[model samples]
Target: MTRSELLNDLEQSLTRLVDGMLVDKGRSIEFLTRLDRLDDIAIDMARGINADARLAGFFADNTPWLLDEDLTTAQKGRAGTLFAEITDLLAARTDEEGLKLGREAEEWSRAMGGRPLRLVLRATREEASLSDRFHALLRREAEEVNMLLAEREHLMTCLDDVLSSAELKRDRMHHHLAASLIYFLKMEGYKVEPYVRRLRRITEILEKEKPC
Candidate 1:
């Protein structure tokens, strides 16, 4: 495909992924909760900006300054002008209304702590975490897949023998096999939690929506 076509295809895939995620009620609720948190954060930021009277920007009521300690009088005056502009924008609304929104936002922030936008976006958009060591470890383990498979086969054989032996009880053998399976999967760089989660979700849905 052409470069533009390839980019379009990737965008389509991402759109489908997002759509599927939103289709689930739980996931949609989770997204809405995040948005609410973002709103609260934005409001808190606006309050801070109004209170500081320095470090002006386009959206003067959105975010705060980097260095609050060393703002010049001139900078503060500039910030005052920006605040005046913001006040003009909110002129139709009473100060009481603005204060109410601020109080509500503060309460909401208390209810659900602060999260910077960058961190939130990183959490939602990224697949792999930003840990080089984790990526390296995953890569190393993946490279040893064949060796891990061999080790797993050996363990399975031993587990079979243990289960069949007269001296071993069924429960003991099952426990040993479970431990071995866990170890083997870890060694092979396979994440079993997602599969377990899928099974649990299926079981929960089935139980809740079973035929009456």
Candidate 2:
């Protein structure tokens, strides 16, 4: 079944189970709050998956240009190293790592001057002095690297938020299902197993989409 259909089924089943319970009003409120939290986490997880897919596509498309053989060996090596470092930093999703990588990338870009850099620098040659052209190339590359670093940082933040939310929901769900209410529902002949099963399936899907 589609995700929306599964979510609807789960919500309806939970609603029915909650309605049949003889719990106090406070307990009912807690159950509903947990349900809402789970739903929000699921939705955010899906959004994060979609965002990661787009970022992967972006990297795939742009990476080859940086690896082009026309660029100098040093330029290509730096580009490859930066890509690797950025990927690792993004996976870790720490601001400190990102800032360190950003500084390294900026320094590398400034020192890098090859065919691609020369081409761009030559374009504005008429408008710039020799020293200005040199600085211009450095600035251009620095700006590009900074933009990429910012994008990676933003994507990593989104990924970290989704992962944390998913973990929180998982713990909450475990606690909620282990409560006496779940036992009461099962004793009443309610089919609550399917809800848990569906949730597991959704978690598996998210796992497959997770970044390496």
Q: RMSDs, each prediction? A: 25.3, 23.8
Query: Who wins the lDDT comparison?
Result: 2
What would the per-residue lDDT of candidate 2 be over residues 1-212, giving only the tens digit for each residue? 99999999999999988876634445434433432332333234323432334334434454444334444343344343333333322343456644554354344334433122222344455655455434533543343233334334543332333334444554332233323233555677765574445445547755676669
Candidate 2's C-alpha lDDT? Answer: 0.42
Residue pairs clashing in model 1 are none
Give, for candidate 1, the lowest lDDT window spanning 10 residues: 112-121
Candidates in order, TM-scores: namely: 0.18, 0.19
Residue 99, candidate 2: Cα error in Å is 21
- Model 2: worst 10 consecutive residues (lDDT sum): 111-120
Q: Give lDDT tens digits, candidate 1, residues 13-78.
A: 999998876665453344334323332333334334342222122224433331243333333332
Query: How far off is model 1, as Cα RMSD?
Result: 25.3
Candidate 2 clash pair list:
none
Error of 1 at 57 (Å): 26
